[model samples]
Target: LLGRFFEARAKGRASQAITRLLELGAKQARLLRQGTQVMVDPLELVPGDTVIILPGEKIPADGVIDAGATSIDQSMLTGESHAVDRGPGDEVYAGTVNQQGRLEVKVTGVGPNTALARIARLVEEAQATKAPVQGLADRISAVFVPVVIVISLGVLATWWIATGDFADSLSNAVAVLIIACPCALGLATPTAIMVGSGRGAELGVLFKGADVFERAKEIDTVVFDKTGTLTRGAMTLTGLDSEADERLFLARVASLEAGSEHPVGKAVALGAEERDIELAPVAGFQAWRGLGATGIVDGVEVAAGRARFMADRGLHIPDRYLEALETFERRGHTAFLAGWGGEVRGTLAVADTMRESAPAAVAELRRIGIETAMITGDSRQTAEVIAAQAGIATVLAEVLPEGKATELARLDAAGRSVAFVGDGINDAPALAAADLGMAVGSGTDVAKEAGDVVLMSGDPMSAVVALRLARATFRTIKENLFWAFAYNTAAIPLAALGFLDPMIAAGAMAISSLSVVTNSLRLRRFH
Candidate 1:
C-alpha cells in the first residue's frame, strides 16, 4: 500500500505546469485612476478599470488595450513564441509579458474568468480524471484465491489418504499456497501505467486515463478543426482587390471598422495601421454580427464585410469583381466587400496562414496509414484551400461548430474509428463524441474536458506522437500481462507435483513478481 501511494504521488508530480502558470502573474498592478497612477492588488481590480502595464511586467487581467503599442510575449499561453504587436482595442490575455512599450488597458476579466485561470483549472481537472488500468493478474486474483485453496486441500487429502503421512501432506499443501504468485499479477498493470503515463508526460502528451492509451491503436481517420488547429487562428488581411485604390479603400474600411472588435474588422484596421495610413473620423458606425461593419467615412457612407452584407444593404457587385473574388477564395482567403457612396469600391481578402509544421505533421500520419481530414466553418473554397496546403485529402467544409459531431457520427457508422483534434470551446461536442479526442493544451476549458488526451505542446505533430506512444504503451502492457500469466501458469502445477520444494516455490513467487516489475520498467526506455 505504501509503495502504491508513492507511485501515485510520483505520477501526479508530472502535472505541475499549471502551478507554474499561476506564479507568472504580477501580484500587484499599477492602476490608472483619473490620470493618477496608484499601486493596488491585482485581485482588487474589476472590469472597465484602466490599468497601466509597463515593460517587463506581467499582465494582470484579460482586456482590450486602450493606449500605447507594445510587443507582448504570449508564448506561455498560446505555445507560439513570437511576440505579437498589441495596441488599442486588441485583446491581451492575463499572465502574458509586456516586452516593450507601456500601455493602459481596460479590464474585461479577472480572477477565475481570466484565460490563464481557466487553463489552470482545466489542467488540474484533466489530471484528476485518469482512471486506473486493470490487468490480467487482477482479474484472475479476484477468483483465483478460492480455487487455489480448494486445490491445496485436495492435494493434502490425497496425500493423507494414500500414505497416512501428515507431514508430507501439510508440506505439499504449503508449497501450493506459496506458489500462487498473486503479487506478480497485482503489480503487472499498475507499474506499466505509472511508467508509460509518466513517459508521456515527459513528452508533453497527457493521457487523461490509462484506458485512453488502449483506444489510440484503433484510430483510422484523424479529423482536424481548421481555425487554430491547422492554421494560426489569427486572421490577417492578405490582399486587396486589384481594382480598388489602395489608399482610398483602406482609409474608408479602416475608419468604418474602428469601433468593431470582430476578427475580420480587426484585420482590416490592423492592415491599414501597418501601412501608416491615418484613419478618418467616422460617424454612424455600426457592426453587423457575422456580416460586416458600416459607417460614414469622408461624408460618404461606407460598408465592409462579406458579400452578403452588401447584398442585404442593396449593394450590387459587378461580374468582373465576383470572378476576381472567386479567385481569391480559391487560394484559401476569406474576402470581404468594401463599398461606399452606393458603388462597390473593391473586395478585401483576409486569410489565416497555415502553421509551418502542419504539412509535415499530416505526412507523418499518412505514412502510418491513418487518413487525415479537415473540418471547418469556412466556405468550401476556403476549406479546400487550407486542406490542400496541409496535405489533407478529405475536406468537410462549411460545417457549423455543432455539426462537426454529426460528421463524426457519419464516419462512425461507416466502421471507421476517428480521432478529432481541436482547440476551442465550440469543438467540445465533437471532441467528446470522437473515438479519441485530443485537445490542444492552449485551448479552452470545455475543449480539455471533451478530450481523452491533452497535447501540452499544442502542436499538431504532438497528436501523432500521442497516438504512437499510446500504441507503444498498450504493447508494453500486453507484454507484461503475457509474461506474468505465463510464469504463474507453468510454475504452480510443478510445485504441486513435488518437482519443486516449498522453499523453491517461495523463491519462484518472489522472482515472478520481480520479473513483472522489471519488464514493466522497460516502458521507461520508450522514446
Candidate 2:
C-alpha cells in the first residue's frame, strides 16, 4: 500500500507530502515491535495424543482422529475450500482452523513430525539451499546495495561542494537513489521458484522446494517399477485360442478357484465375469495358495493351475497347448491350464497389461532428451516385455526392494542423477536414495513423505508434467537472476554521484522488492 502511495505521488497522481507521511505511519506500524503479554512456551504435538481443540485456538501438533470428529478449515496451509470432515484415523495437520465441531484427536506426530513443522523445514531448506545457477544473483546483490549507498552520499557531497547549492545536490541524490532501487534484483530467483512450484501443484505435482525442482531439470535418466507402477498390478485375460467350449472351461475354473486368493484365481473369475459365463458351483473347494485350487465343479473333479498341477492330477495337456503356454510366459504373461478329470480342455492367459498413457509418456520423455529405464522385481521376461512395450531404453529385472537403492547409487556413480518413480513400500528406499525421488499420489504416506516430489495423480503422464514444470522453473530462475543483477548494477553508479534522491531511493527499493514478489507469483499460471 505504501508502495502504491509513493508510486502515485511520483507520477503526480497524488500530492507528495501527505502520501509520504501516511506511508511513514504505515511503515512505523509494521516496524513497531510489541512485547508479549505472557511467556508460555508452545507445546509439541504428537500423533495419537488426545488433543482438545478450542474455538479460535491453534492446533499444537499433527494428530489423527481418535474419537470425536471435526470440521477443520485448512485454507491457510493447503488452500483448501470449506471445512474438512475429519473422523477417526484421518490425518489433521497443524495450523488448520477448527471452524466447527469439537475435535478429540489422537496425536500421531509431534513437534518436528507435524505437517506444519515439515513445511517449515522445507521452507527453511528452500531458503538455505541455493541452486548452483541461482547464486549469481545473490552475489551481485550483496555487492550492489552498499556500493549504491556510498555512491549516493559521495554524489550529494560533491555536488554541494562544487555548486554551493545544498538543496539542488540533495534533489540530484534523491533522483539517483530513486532510479537505482534493487527491486528487480531481489525479485528475480525466488519469484520464479514460487511460480514454478505453484504451477506444479495445479497439475497434481508438488515439489518440496526449489533445489529439488532444479534437480529434475538435470536428470538424463529415469527408472520405473513394473507392477503397480507400470501395469495395473492385477492380471486379466488377454486372448483365448482353444477348442471344446473355452467359456465352459473358464466358468468351471472360476468356480473352482473362487475361494482362492491367488492372482490366477482372481484372473479366472474376472475373465468369466467379462464373458458373462454362468459360474459352476464347486463342492469341497480347496486352495494351494501359490500353486492352484481344486474343487468338485458340476459333480466333476476340476483343477486349474500351472502345468505341474495338471500333470500331477494325471491330466494330459496336448503339446500344442504347452507350446502356447510357453510362448505366452516368454512374452511376460501368466497362463493357467484348465482341465477336467484327465484331459486338458482350455487355456486362460492372464497378464497385467500396460496403461494406455505409458507408451505416449515414454515417447514424450525421449523427445525431451530424457533416457527412460525400468526396474522391477518381476521375472526377466516380464520386465523386458513391459519395457519393450513402453519404449523404455533400459531394464532392470528381478530387483527386490532392497536392491533398488543399490541400482540408483550405481546410476549416480555413472554420472547420472537418478529419479526413481514408484508407488509402493518397495519404492521407499529407492525414493530416498535417488537424486530426485517422485511418488505417485496413490502411494503410502511414508513414500510420499520420503519423496522430494509427489504427484497427486498416479498417471505415468504426471512424470512428463513434473519435468515440464522443472524446466519452466529453471527458466524462471534465470530470468529472475538477470533482472535482479541488472537493477543493482544500474542503480549504484547513479546513487554514488548525487544523481539520486532519498524519497526516490525509498520508492525504488519498494518497487524492486515488490516486482520480485509479483514475478514469483507467475508460477501459479503454470497449472
Winning model by TM-score: 1
Candidate 1 structure quality by residue, lDDT tens digits, 82-157: 7888898798888889999999999998888787776655445444443234644565888988888898898888
Candidate 1 — what's its lDDT? Answer: 0.78
TM-score list, all predictions: 0.74, 0.60
Give lDDT per model, in order. Answer: 0.78, 0.66
Q: Candidate 2, TM-score vs. the true structure? A: 0.60
Count backbone overlaps in model 1: 0
The regions of model 2 sitting more than 4 angstroms off are: 1-143, 174-181, 237-325, 334-349, 443-448, 495-511
Give the residue spans of candidate 1 off by over 4 A: 1-139, 162-168, 242-262, 276-314, 338-344, 443-450, 501-506
Q: For every candidate structure, what is the RMSD over all alpha carbons to the true structure, in angstroms? A: 5.8, 12.5
Model 2 per-residue lDDT tens digits across residues 1-527: 44444323222311221222222211100011142222222353333346566555555556665656767766444433446677777777655666666666565655556554544344434444556665776676678668767777887899899999998888877676566655565446555664565455445566776688678988888787766666766777775646877777777888887777655577778888988988877798876533566889989998877777789889999987887777786877766688886988877677886877889989988899888899976556656877889988698876656788899999999999778888634477898999898876431242236688876456688888888878877876776666666666676566655545677767676767666555555655664
